[model samples]
Target: MDLYIYNKALALQNVMDTYGSLRWVRRYTECGEFELHCPFTVDNIRLLAQDNIIRKKDSDEVGFIEYRNVKRDETDRENLIVKGKLGEGYLNRRIVWGREILNTTYELALRTLVDKNCINPTDTTRIINTLILGDIGNFTGNINFQVSYQNLLKVVEALCLEAELGNRIRFDKTLKKLKFEIFQGLDRTSSQTVNPQCIFSKEFDNILDQEYTDSIMDYRNVALVGGIGEDADRRLLTVGSGTGLERFEAFNDQKGISNMVDNVEMAEAEYSALLSSKGNETLAETKKVQTFENGVNLNSNLRYKVDFDLGDIVTCMSKKWGITIDSRINEIEEVYEESGKEVNIVFGKEMPRTIAQKIKLL
Candidate 1:
């Protein structure tokens, strides 16, 4: 597989068609990443430095190198290991300026956040001239959310996941800018007859290897939100209202969430709704995770991208295990090595892999 290299400025650089091994991963709810191992050569070393960009032809996932290391085996063989996160992670570099309460379609809310902080902030010093919002999202659903002093990427991702949506920041080669967009996957499950269904089942000989996990260890469906004030007088709200054995409650402290927007004090009910919105978003991070991972046979009737792609909801069943899953294609991994190319698919959200994700579990 050929890989194109570019500077962070989008300038064309070296291309590395030969590599020891490569792991390119794409995700729906989070930024994608890539790990590349290549022969230790002067050109490779110069091309794989931090801040450089790597991309695969015809793929929307573009990543910036963040790490590079040289490895030497006992036999004195040397190779370079390079790793990076996708351009979407650029949001991680920014933070919400202050308290933000959005009560509009999530599509516009997400764009407004990026626009205010990165593209065209009221503070001219914060403007990223080359970054622009794109017209890529059309999901229609009102969301009342509040966030303050938090990482921009994490907030946007949480909202997207709760809304059953996805997002990306694609490099506009000709325009020389990064376009941030929100998107939702198509429904391709067998339950729907309108579109061609993409099913992967052991019975069909397409699922090569499979592991299924259903866990509630980190799941909580109810949230008791605490707002400004003290004791019983404090503004309190609950989201994901459930009761009895069905209730899985957690507490969300949103004292920083102000009842005022743009210097005007909002009505009590309106402020309560905003508090509940923030609580709901916190609860969303504790959703029950039912993830499926497996090797896929590309030669099977189901073709990658053509039949189904990342973010598409597809059905998966294992008659042997007596479990069936209808979930979004949350992740796709492409591996390139000397032997050949291989693809693996991950359905549904997997366990939290980063410190930020793990903290939410606590």
Candidate 2:
């Protein structure tokens, strides 16, 4: 078989052997969409066993260690086979294979760090920093250092802040803003003079100029909160309804009307109850029912007029009218026959062209 396929088969068997059953393993091989158990085939089982990928258990008789469903009191033989197949397929896919390799590389790095004593049980931050930067000089100490978990977290936070500051300095060139001047006198009697200038003064000035220009443009566009020419009181007045002085009084009247409606409803209900008590039985059966419907109303109209402007009169009398006219020569006809019209032309040169020819088809 292909080397890749063989390796995947072996990997699936190994997973099954490690977990004591293919069904229980978190990652295995599948066929269609990538699952965990597509590799354990009849022909490859013996080969996998020889490679120690699949382990055989001898309990009275030699048998493959299969996953058992404890709840069902049955062996998960089909799931085990399916998982092997899925795992094999996953190994075959190139992207999945690359991801697995990258994962293994990181795992190897972690393992090396642990073995070399660069990472301790408590110092997770130092471990991460060492792994990323490949510098463990600061982490060298006794493994049994009496440090609390919170202290280790603090160290991690401090290291992170240091890294962030270092990155900012590297990218922003903040350190370059600090200038150093060295002055020396050739003779004992000689003197030197030094003058200093602010490095960011020009940059700050440019920023302010741009901000002022932007503010002017914003004011010209429209008034908004925090923008130039914005009237805070006018904006507040126009916020809702825009009725100004009348809004407050109208709101109070509306509240009063609602209260009156509620009171009237209550009184009517109480009167009906009193009537029922007085043996007016038919009044108790009467009840009000309300229904509501939502809909949209649209209206369209077209109006035509003749214009008599001085410019139009001049253009009509002028030798070279100085106007280029667009002619839609085609006519729209609503053809009507004795048996009613079979077709109607609504728009430009209408022969009902294909969708590709329609400009507004979308």
Candidate 3:
């Protein structure tokens, strides 16, 4: 692994040989991010800034696709920490930085973020075309709103939630573009499965430890949303809807979805999505596994190698814990140090949407 810093013209600026540690993280619901800790030398400080580019190279392959310096810190003036996000740092850029979009298709809505050269002002051809765009329905009667100072990523999340179609948006580091994918479960045959013992050798264990958690917090019978409109001097309206969860219990939740829509129809649509999506599911379980190489090289062969990515479904078994999970990879965090790299995987089933996700209605 190697770290390279570059200038705006793509010129080699600085390289790190005695860095502290490097971390790369991937989340199912958001963009991946990276941080580099290195000595705060004069040469390194000169190459580090808010707009400078950083690249993590694994052999000849680009590990993070791309990263931009969004923040810098020199706590003791001896070691510096640079923090940033991946794929042009779209999350750090405000929605107001992009072009205005109104009542557009889901595809166009995403395109507007990158089409107007808002993501990267210097490079227009950096975004790749291997996007997994999903349908967001053909309803032209969608809500109307404007982009203020919110980040591009947050806006996209709200849009996906409002679409209410299991839609997801992520920055594909390897593909070098924004990916709009909808959850369609997993294709079992193509997925890699990990067990307490390796598939090739039961003598060599792959799982070090495991744990399980179950929750009913997502269960709800009613989803009530109330918000003020543009012409409101006070609370304008309240809308309540149910998903027929009387079988479970008389559970109810209230949300403030204010100043986000232009009319009642759009507001109702938002409420319906919330009720239908949040009420039907109640049982939630997550399985965390500590493994070697993240179960990648455990069963490798000439023709077969096991690997996993965000949202990929994999099977895990822990005889000690008495748990067998065929779950989706929800989060991944990796740490690289002088000793070696540690990759931690979190697997879960049935994740509930949060209030922050209702930004689409706003």
Summarize candidate 1's per-residue lDDT along 111-214 as a digit string, tens digits. 99999999987888878766788884568988887788899998888888778788887888778777888888889998999889988776897766767777
Off by over 4 Å in 3: 59-77, 96-108, 113-150, 158-204, 218-221, 227-306, 318-322, 349-362
Tens-place lDDT per residue, model 2, 163-260, is 21110000012221111111111111112123211111112221111100001111111111111123442211111122443332111011111112
Local error of candidate 1 at residue 77 (angstroms): 2.1
Candidate 2 global CA lDDT score? 0.19
TM-score of 1: 0.91
lDDT of each: 0.80, 0.19, 0.45
**How well is each residue in 260-290 modelled by candidate 3, as lDDT tens digits?**
3444345555545433332322211111222
Query: Worst 10-residue stretch by lDDT in candidate 3?
Result: 353-362
lDDT of 1 at 303: 84
TM-score of 3: 0.56
For model 2 the TM-score comes to 0.14
TM-score of each: 0.91, 0.14, 0.56
Q: What's the number of clashes in each of the models?
A: 0, 23, 1
Structure candidate 1, residue pairs in collision: none
